[model samples]
Target chain A: MKLIGENLNIMSKKYGAALKAKEAKPLQELAIEQAKAGMDYVDLNIGPASKTGVDLMTWLVPVIEEVVDIPLALDTSNVKAIEAGLKACKKHRPLINSIMVRPERMEALLPLAAQYDAEFVGLLWGPEGMPRDENERGALCAELVFKATGEFGIKPERIFVDPIQTPVNVQQIQIMSVLEFMKMFADIAPGCRSTIGLSNVSNGPPDHLRPILNQVMLIILKRHGMYSAIVDTYDTMLHEIARDKHPGLEALVHKVEDGEAVDMTHLSDEERSFVKTAKVIMGQALYSDSWLEI
Target chain B: MTFQPSKQVYSGKIREVTLGSGDKAVTIGGRGVYAFHSFEGAMPNAPRIAMEVWDKDPSEDWAAAAKAPFGDVLADPAAWASKCVKEYGAEIIVVQTKSADPNGDNRAAADVAATVKKVVDSVDVPVIVWGVANHEKDTEVMKLVAESCAGKKVALSPVEEGDYKQIGAASLGYNQLVVASSPIDINLAKQLNILLGNLGVKAENLLIDPTTGGLGYGLEYTYSVMERAGQAALTQEDEKLQQPMIANVANETWKCKESNLSTEDAPELGDAAQRGILMEAVTAVDLMLAGADVVVMRHPEAIKLVRNYIAKMM
Candidate 1:
């Protein structure tokens, strides 16, 4: 499984200096920690720097790249900013993160991705809206895969598909959609890899609760064949759990992926409540106790 | 969809274990697929034989088939072992400690150790010290045998459920390879392996004996058990069942009634000597295909036939 550090985005803007004269100490620290925690790639997302997006990404890519040689995901809403970061990444090619089904952005990004020989990331969303069901997401992903191979000449193996995760608080159906999309994505594009911006699923939740939400979602998502994850690589607990692999965790993940209720009687009351919340979000069963102890 | 054979992908590999330190050493296992699935996996080391050399005298009350080839060396184990390696090109020598059996002469441990020492000093090839079925007697004899061949790196046998701690401790102390012997039960075999591991036996210092049965004597059950153990090692990635296996083919085949009975006694059964040799040979070759890495056998003709079979298979 590939772990991507997602700490250097607009979520922590104070660490991103104007000209990087203040040494960008926090940015370097997070990169080092993520790399040490066995993250195969570090994500450098200077979110929405419209006026200075290109310059900030260009400066930040090298600062993180200078410390760790692992691959970086050049994430930005603007296509030009991703291109600027691509130029600065000297040694290892960066995976472009990411593009939707918008034609204009796809035209600018896919060719640059092919020209640089870098792997690309594509989302399930199009110009109209995000897909509401599994086959809808699968059809959209299959279209990108066909175009990625036939039009741009980028190999299917090089593209990483992100199904565009939605927070369960807003719409619960998306949890099942994400799992189904992940399960079906491999068959849709045989050699392509499946990934998720894992922290987004826990968005808007309390900070203390976010870790459990993110980790549990990752566990279930992995069972559905989500091989790559963009997470807080600095969280030592995630690394510990990953290293100490357990059969029970896989059993629970398997049950959740199958959309069946798991036997959570062995877990603590608090842990079971969290799992119960997950069952509600995953649509495996109807919500019973909203006043549950989570 | 077009039909395609699903390729087997495994997460674990058999540990390659070597006995006898230097040039004449033999290593087995380490393949990641079924016995001869060389197209998908590696088969690095070829299977070898450990020719039998008995501690008791072979002349008295022994079958004529076994005594024909080893007539002169029957009384002397060292001479028999030397003839096995030098004349027949046997890969390893197995000194069967039959004299130490309680029902028989019940020879002292020192006597068994002395014969083992002579065989070890006589043969350049690696030696395997097989104990009699008596647990307490084998523990006593193997302790002495382990001291006799300290640095020779011999393989000690019959480390069963009851005597694993005793035999396992002796093997560890002397740095010898301990064969985890179990009945024709895969679970018992795996459990005994776990016990040996708990006794501090490294993966590289262990062997498996699923207990051989002669041809027409429940050989199918033995074959199935061995096949299942191989599947666990290669496909399912169970580490404990991964060690190379051995079967005392000569012991089971020679003692069978069909092989030992003469034409006069049972005229329907043809030549007793010829039938005996074929029985051992057939049992040995079948076990090899069923994933036995080492086979201990009598009769030079039987050994030759098995060698020819392995030549084509390996």
Candidate 2:
């Protein structure tokens, strides 16, 4: 299982600015913290570095590589940037952010992965945007496996399939679709592993509720063969909950994921619920004595 | 497309495992594709057969068909091994530690090492020294055999998870190949290989035995599992399972009740000798198709049949 640290990326301007100026202190801090938290790879996404993507990557690769001993996941769709970062990477099995079933993405990234001897994340979507259901997602994933392995000659185990997880607020049933794809990832490509963009489920949800939603979805997806994740490794709660704290959690998560009532008698309604920690954090739950116990 | 074969593109080669030192060495595996699937990928080394010979003579208990080929040399393992490499066309020799079983002669490790030395000197083709499935006794005997055959690189067989540390340490110290054996489970098989690697055994010094299942008795299960391991080796680049595989098919087939029965009782089965030989041959062929790199078998006729089958395919 690969626990990827995905905090330092171009999604936020704070992170973007840090990479733009080749800032080392803040990035080094994140790398050391993620490395201490048992992350297999610290993902480096340079979305704001788009214009100078290749240049920024060439600069940031050695900066992060100097401080962190763990491998770095080069998070970008830019081919030149990925190659630049890969060249700068030394003694690390740098993991590529993604490729897809689309002709351009597959033809470009798959061969790059083979040439650089790197593991890659194959996104389960083409240029036409994300799949609406689990079946299409699976089909696309299978196509990714078929081409990456059958054509590009990359090892199946080296490829990690990303079943695109969008915000549940936008696509309510997406939670189930991604989970279902994770369940079938093994059969799609026997030795291949599944990964999810952790924060995607919380994209439209409230800022305070994001981590709770992300953590819950992570636990649920992990049950269905989700091994690797593009996750914020600094979230102590996410790391804590990853171990499967409660026994009936799986059944409860499944029931809720399937949009059915949990039949487990052992757990309380709040305990079986998805937004427990979020409600507590937002002061919606009364400060009862047994509140922390649950 | 000519109803084309299912082709898989793989970059990882099953580690070409070499046995014996200097001039006598023979390599197995080193193919980048599934066994005999040359319509797509290259199978560099044609799978070899290692004939089995026991240290002590079995005058009567031996299956009539099995004993017929080497009737005179049965008393002396050296002569038997010599005959296998010399005449019967054995590419390699397998010396079983069956007599070392506590139920049988219970020969001590030192005594067994002397016999091993005799066979080692008799045959130039590399030897495989296998133990009774017993963990403690096998550990002792295999370690002594490792010491006796130091620098010779004879493959030491039946290195189970329980006794891996001892056997692995010996292989590491003596610089020999270790046969990482597991009970028909791919995961268990991979784990043993990983443990052996951690014990300093090089990838080239490893061979996998995925515990061969006999014909008509869960042979399909072995086929699927072996196929899975081979796929992992080639496509997944799983170094643990990515080494030559040796199937003790003859031993498994011989132990089955179907192969041992005389035609007098089961007369419908036809000639007992021919039936037994076919059973061994068919099992070896099935194992080869399932990505076996070296097949350890008994009987001259089965060896010839398997060899001929391999020749036509190659």
Candidate 3:
């Protein structure tokens, strides 16, 4: 699985302070570490940089580029800031962190993405906001792809469609909806890659139990042909599972996905936790902060 | 509308592994696409054949045609290996240590190591020492073989899950290559490669043996697993499964009843000689298509047939 580092975000407390101060050291250090951790791309999530969006992106893009060799995903709500970051990317192909399915966002960002010849993630959030089900996601994907490829002349291969992951604790039904959307994504927009904000699944869960949900969800998503994921690069075990170095764990998760009656007594502690977490995501078991304890 | 062919864009490439050393070293596995899909991407190294030479004389049980080419040197593996290289144009020689099997001659590890060294010295090309599947015996014999041919870069085959530690350490200590063997399952194959890597086997010093099965004898299973291995290496970009694969086609193909059953015993099966050669060639070709980097083959005619097929395909 291709990993887009989600650690260097403007939302993190330390990095957010550093971004506000325009400090380059902390961001550069984190970028280098993420690349060493085998992140295929680093997401520069300068969330809604409304005031200093353009200047922060223009300055930060080159700052991060100078430190790491991997590509950068320019993430922001500011249209001009995205274009500025795209212009500043000299070393690698830049990915526009998102272009929403909404008309105003598409009209503003699609042409900028096409002009820069940049790859963009197609976020399946319609004008009414978050799709009701897989069918709604599918319809939004068709409209976004048709405009991106048909009108802007952008190729499908360059677009990554994100079905928008929902937290498993409160939005368990949407967990299955996104998976259903992923199953039909290729048919809807052939050659378009897919990614997800993997941490979203565990958003409402306790901090200590978040990695388990993310790891299990990653394996389940990969089985359904997820191309990439925006993930916590520092989670060593999660990356190991992504590289298929832990087949035993992946097989246990697959067993839960396949609906096999797993004998819990025979599993190791880690394998048993993976099974439980997968069941929660599949909605076979109720979600709780102490699910692993159960 | 233009007819645009839907070609898969692979994000990974197989790590190239070099066998032997000096002038005659052969490198395999550096392809960015599936085996023989050169039109889509680059397959820099073509699949090769390493003819097999057994440690013990097998004229008693061997079919007449399989035995005909090396009749003069059947008793001596060094001589047999020389004949394969000097006459038949073999690029690599695989010394099958049948004598070390505890159920067979039960030869001492020292004796087998000497035989392997002799064969390695006799050939200009790379030598691969194949062991009996018994873990304890292969560990003992291959450790000595690794020592005897230190720095020669000869490969130790069938270094399985049971003996990867002992043999993998010896290969690292002596600068030899290891063929990581597993049952015909893609998961087990990747797991073994991961184990070997954890044991410090570098990417260039490893080969995958997914446990070959002959035509009509679980060939489909082996083929599918190999194809999956190829896809995982190139498309899924799974680092552990990216090593070039080596299929022991000769051992599996020649031993099957379809290759050995005489026409008198089974009249409808046709001539035993031609049938065995075709079976070996067909199995080798099928395996190459499914991503075999090197196929251990028997019978000069079968080798010739496979060479022609590879040449035409390339």
Per-candidate alpha-carbon RMSD to the true structure: 22.5, 22.7, 20.6
- Each model's fraction of native contacts: 0.00, 0.00, 0.00
The lowest-lDDT stretch of 10 consecutive residues in candidate 3 chain B is B185-194
- Cα lDDT for residue A56, model 1? 81
lDDT of 3 by residue, B237-296 (tens): 667778999999999999888888887887898888999999999999999999999999
lDDT of 3 at B12: 87
Instruction: Give the DockQ-based CAPRI class for model 1.
Output: incorrect
All candidates: interface RMSD: 19.2, 21.9, 13.7
Candidate 1 local lDDT, residue A267: 84
Residues A1-294, model 2: lDDT tens digits: 468888887776777677777888888888888999988899998873467889989988888889889898898878889999889899699999877779988888888899988988888887688888889998888788888888878898788888887765445456657766667778778988778788886775457657767776776767677877888786776776666654355555555555554454776754645544332222222111122333
Worst 10-residue stretch by lDDT in candidate 1 chain A?
Answer: A285-294
Clashing pairs for predicted structure model 1, backbone only: none
* Stretches of candidate 3 exceeding 4 Å from the true structure: A1-294
lDDT of 3: 0.91
- Every model's DockQ, to 2 decimals? 0.01, 0.02, 0.02
Residues B1-314 of candidate 2: C-alpha lDDT, one tens digit per residue: 47975667885779888988878789989899989988777888999999999888876666788888999999999999999988987889999877888878899878887898889989888999988878888898988989988988999989998999999999999899989898887656766777777778999999999898989887887887799788777875666678899999888888787787888978988888998899999999999999998888989999999999999999
Itemize residue pairs with steric clashes in candidate 3.
none
